[model samples]
Target: MNKFYTAQEVADKLKIKKTTVYELIKRGELSSSKIGKQLRVSEDQLSLYLNGAAKNSVSAQHHDYQPESSLLKRDYLLHSSGLIISGQASPALDLLLNQLPSTPGNLPVLQSHMNTYNGLYSLYFEKVHIACAAAAPEDVRSLVPGLSLTALLFCQYPMGFYVKKGNPRNIHDFPDLTRADIIFANREKGSSRRVLLDRTLKSSGISPESISGYRNELVSDYSTAAAVAGGQADVALGESYAVRSFPELTFLPLTQETLYLIMHSENLDTPGFQAVTETISSENFRRTLALQTGYDTTHTGEIFSI
Candidate 1:
């Protein structure tokens, strides 16, 4: 369906008057178009406007020193905020960092525990401009409508068991986790890995409770890796990047998962967003990803739009 909202529709959605919406459009705070003398907005654009407005206001209040650029550069790359990578897609972020020119100036990049669903929520709230997620095709199709997306070929990473150092118990496959002595460190819900694991177990006629140590959960793949490294658990299921981070553990390849670049469509043409896309698609970037331990770069930068 076409995404078009009238001034009255916007006013009703935001609990304001039609005149107020008109004023916003006049001041260029909201995006609209002329359709036979009537103004209209994209449903996605309105959601972004409302979300960005609230977030920018709170941010301005906290800083106590809001600059003129904050109010003026809403449509441009005038602001630089730290990029968050959820659950350790280090190779992709590394490629992004290398491609960004340092001679111009340095930019901030911070890693956080933002899984698939949570990362999308952050994008909706305007908390972060870009996020790395291992979301499935079906999940993307279910998101709140009206939003636009641009997916970059991140990496083809394998989903597998992270066994303790030296593979002491000789754990070979998913079925091995059901052993009485094997301690499994699980990832929380909302993570793509968790969804894959749940579906696999269900298809295999295995109740989650049948697996040992199902009661405990880790917030991220890194934490799960840490749990295995610390002898707290015998195995953890996560992506290839997690195994690369902790060399002491043995990685068992199970399945291949594609990691993608996620961002609001409005920001698609922004310099920063374009830089992110170009960086991911470059030959140097692909080589770097290929060199990174345990990642397959064959499908990097492929687009799978919802």
Candidate 2:
């Protein structure tokens, strides 16, 4: 049987600090399981992370990656001009992709799970055709620097703090997070949610360091919500619709953000883009998304400039 090690145990074995171990787990780099509200890394998981650490280093992923060059392209994307979207997995997008012509290959056809910065990065290099982002107006505009971007209003949903049932911490506002009682679950950097949280924190004049567990990150809305639900965290940011299925969590609405499907203006005239637009505009698509995801899809298919 694989032995489960505490965060401190894992940290000692790797010759790193306990906080660093939590940071690794927060980044989703080190696999761990929650043991009655405490995180533990199995022996096998630690070995797997150590094995992949060399090839998937931070330097290579964050700084050295070159998506524009032919040498470093994602082979699964197929066809230089093919439609590849980057964002959280969506069944609606899947159905739309199924309508497109398939490139016969052994590789699986899938959307890259990169959102915000990384998604826009892929788009900037033409590695991806579309990117889904939810953020403030100004921040969204800064995604693509040189390229003129055309955005299609996708969905509007409530973005807020996810707290445990009854919100025992009574985390009603941003200032409440500063209290020593609340253990926050933050989203990873570069994610649109994290960007929103950071900008909000700045504007609200709430120092991130003041919040307990503010540095304890989780990779996705669901994961963050799950942490709160599992009692691993006191508060986490997420979309109202995304965390709806996570039981034992109360979503305190802070603001609503419109998610947009953004792409380069140069590809606006392409047949692939045209099909994508058409699919989004269909009554069924808009209605289905609203009903299933609880997103405001009234303007889902409308085009706009960012």
Instruction: Please name the candidate that would achieve the greatest lDDT relative to the true structure.
Output: 2
Number of the predicted model whose TM-score against the real structure is largest: 2
lDDT per residue, candidate 2, 257-284, as tens digits?
7777888887776677776777677787
Residue 271 displacement in candidate 1 (angstroms): 1.5
TM-score for all models, in order of appearance: 0.65, 0.71
Q: Which parts of model 2 are misplaced by more than 4 Å?
A: 1-81, 90-109
- For model 2 the TM-score comes to 0.71
Worst 10-residue lDDT window, candidate 1:
76-85
